[model samples]
Target: MAQKERVGVVVSNKMDKTAVVAVENRSPHPKYGKIVVKTKKYKAHDPENQCQEGDRVRIRETRPLSKTKRWELAEIISTKAI
Candidate 1:
């Protein structure tokens, strides 16, 4: 039983207590070492409605609260800082 963590971009924070985040991962090719980009979208529980779209955030696996929610916002790693 290990916890999973990820860094992603906030896609939407319009929900009352939730936010849609998109995680992007870049991997190097095994042969040519070319970087490949991929993105994944996840629904995370915000509980505070403080996240905003385009903001980078870290999330962790958590107890499911609904059919589509199994992640929670852990922290804001980097932001525009305004």
Candidate 2:
């Protein structure tokens, strides 16, 4: 089976070999029918330590590498200038 993948922005890269990614999406409320913005954070493995805060990245799901990491850095889509 193909592994799950997500495109999100890098939120934190303080931990060695790890980065936090925030994935945001819009969803309609069940009762109110109002659009809601949802954001989720995932801990992704970054072996090269190339990802930085505010960078756009793609992560793929994998076997758990740590207590909070089940995703691995797939590719960096874009880099933050600052």
Candidate 3:
């Protein structure tokens, strides 16, 4: 199996018992080394997942939870925003 990893910000925790995370990715241009931004959203499980907006978090790919949820909360790795 392939291991999955992602770093993101907790955009919302307003669901009944879940959190909506927005993972923004930054990469450098291939030739010029200029930064570029990309983003993706993941709906992860939050069992006692007391996270708030603007909080940095880590998530991992997992089996489907609902119709569109295929990720799970892995860990909260930081106490400050990057």
lDDT winner among the candidates?
2
lDDT of 2 at 69: 95
Cα deviation at 72, candidate 3, in Å, is: 0.8
**RMSD (CA, angstroms), candidate 2:** 0.9
Question: Worst 10-residue stretch by lDDT in candidate 2?
Answer: 73-82
Of 1 and 3, which scores higher on TM-score?
Answer: 1
Off by over 4 Å in 2: none
What lDDT would each prediction earn against the true structure? 0.91, 0.97, 0.83
In Å, residue 17's CA in model 3 sits off its true spot by 2.1
Local error of candidate 2 at residue 44 (angstroms): 0.3
Candidate 3 Cα errors over 4 Å, as ranges: 30-33, 80-82
TM-score, model 1 to reference: 0.86
Q: For candidate 3, lDDT tens digit of each residue in 3-23?
A: 698889988888866778898
Error of 2 at 7 (Å): 0.7
Highest TM-score, which number?
2
lDDT of 2 by residue, 1-82 (tens): 9899999999999999999999999999999999999999999999999998999999999998998899999999999996
Residue 41 in model 3: lDDT: 89
Ranking by lDDT: 2, 1, 3
**Residue 38 in model 2: shift from native, Å?**
1.2
Error of 2 at 47 (Å): 0.3
Of 1 and 2, the candidate ranking higher by TM-score: 2
